[model samples]
Target: MDRWAWANGLLDMAETLVIQQRGVRLYDGDDKTKFDSGTLLLTTHRLLWRNQKTSDCCISLPLWQIVFFEEQAAGIGKSAKIIIHLQVAAPNKESGPYQSSKYSFIKLSFREHGQIEFYRRLAEELSQKRWERISVPQPVPAGRSQPGRVKAVGIVGIERKLAEKRKETDKNISEAFEDLSKLMNKAKEMVDLSKSIANKIKEKQGDISEDETIRFKSYLLSMGIADPVTRETHGSGTHYHMQLAKQLVTMLHAPLEEQGGMMALTEVYCLTNRARGMELLSPEDLVNACKMFEALKLPMRLRVFDSGVMVVQLQSHNEDEMIASALETVSERGFLSSEEYAKLVGISVLLAKERLLLAEKFGHLCRDDSVESLRFYPNLFLTQD
Candidate 1:
């Protein structure tokens, strides 16, 4: 889990194991912080306390431990349906205790809450805690005879020979470093050589970098799904697997432009690598891909937001594409809020904000505070310059 730990366990939440259907709303008859009536979805993995109109965050619950809750729900209905009422109860928790009410608690006393059924469905799902422990089935079958799984036609695979070559190269490089260290600091010229190489490459350097990037991108595209990093090894043996893991991530960057000129670099990494079948990369490679794109003038960037989430931006992505989608979004909904824009773009709020900011600068969009940094239909922002 070193890969997981370094990436802030970004993958942990990636597969929450808990699932939901139909959102719920939370509202207060009169908003008060301490005493509220909003409903929360309690689960073996998390306490998905939520408001329907907005996304919900599932707070985690410990397994096999006793927890005291201010309240809990027994069942749901409008006319004072059954409630667990943990207001004065000590909750029992366990890791898949193979029984009901063995995991965690949810409190429903917040008066600001909207409805209770949302939490009710949650209770029903959690009551079957053993089911939640089961892994989601593979989307497609690998082949030949599997029950409860659709036969999947061939997952793509990357070249192991190419991978091994890369690995051997890496190993050689590592050994070279060790040997060089004994040579009394002869490595000082590495920086000068790299700069000299950069200078010598000049304009062509960008072209070559870009060309190679595109080449690899095409390679990744034609590439079948990557082999699991565990193909031979037990647990991802080294950093080389990490790079192979990032291939899908670098590959998907192009598609992001249409959404909003951006994507979460971390998310892109997760999704792309996931598509590659659980091979993964270090955050450093993710950063490197962003930098490579930036160096190539690909309108892509590694944005460090005030919120501190990192994202990849694609400036070259057509505004017409986003605006085209935006037109549909607004047409469907009357006006696109920041929340709606993100939904339309299929990206995070941080990326949505960057797209809005870029649009405002480019005259392709307009924003009002009511829209909360969201923009619509362009005006001539370019006229000032």
Candidate 2:
């Protein structure tokens, strides 16, 4: 397309790869271009197409030039395509395959069937507009100040500079959340800026703050999702919940692994909302989305205990494994209460009780009710006899 520019296939500073696919063809509007087969790369700033055979030949179009895009489904004898509508070619656009064009759009034909995922990622990138964030300056080199910039000399000067920086950060935070509509528009920028500040503080002082809540919040902000699935993007009803379930599975995978392979739904809701930044999810919506985890065949599923507590746990967190582990623990201690087991295993008392109860149900353990505490003991009838 005329909007494209000749590129050397190297990414610009701060630009990062989003996704890539092979067997893609470029079209100048509805007409096919010479680039019939190649690898298409989606980066934070550009859409680059590299020749499949001649690696040196490459072209890129800045994402800023894109007005919008839509998918054209695969049909009889045709591959699926993404039609990218573009703004008018800028006068300073670099030399490309075409010096001029009759149309204001281009098409990318995906022969190998990756259009669905490509479209999804592309939509997310556009929504987040990471290219805008790329302009943020990297840390200055040690012992160097920008030309014409004053360098702080003594402790007093350094303290003053720190105070000014803190004031600026506070101001930015205040402006970002002054209005609901404004907060939504600036959420990604604010999150990224806050994370950068937190990282700098950690690198210099070894922690963001002394307060435990602030430290935990900074950790949550560090895990902020770039683009969360919402009805606005995926549509409402079953489709939205299905997409939401998939996104939750991807986002919670690491957190779940760290939390002994399971987390209470309430904890999940808090973490998910915090990681989502301004896009807070409702409890009802979260429950609805989690209900589809099994239907969608995700790595995790929602479970409701007999006592009405709900949890999201990895599929690999098998009941048999839990029961066996609990039985072993009870056997080692001779008898154990849920509270004691919870402390030993570093899990919630409720979950510990559930595990012990499950082992009892399987005849691997026996329960005793006493004035002091209820405890579980290995079933002597089955084990000793």
TM-score of each: 0.29, 0.44
| Best candidate (score: lDDT) | 2
**lDDT of candidate 2 over 1-385, digit per residue (tens):** 8898788998865577888888899999999999999999999888999998999999999888889999998899998899999999889667888999999999999886567778999998898787775532435879976897565569986587577557656865876667766767688798999999888767767544458657766776686999998654554467778988999998899878877788889889998998898878989999999999988888999999887889999998877877888888888989999999999998878878887887888899998999999999989899665
Tens-digit lDDT track for model 1 on 118-174?
344455444544334433232343675566654323332225434544765686699
- List ranges where model 1 is wrong by over 4 Å: 1-225, 228-246, 249-261, 276-279, 294-310, 313-316, 319-334, 345-347, 370-385
Model 1 scores worst on lDDT over the 10 consecutive residues at 1-10
Worst 10 residues of 2 by lDDT: 130-139
Off by over 4 Å in 2: 1-221
RMSD of 2: 17.3
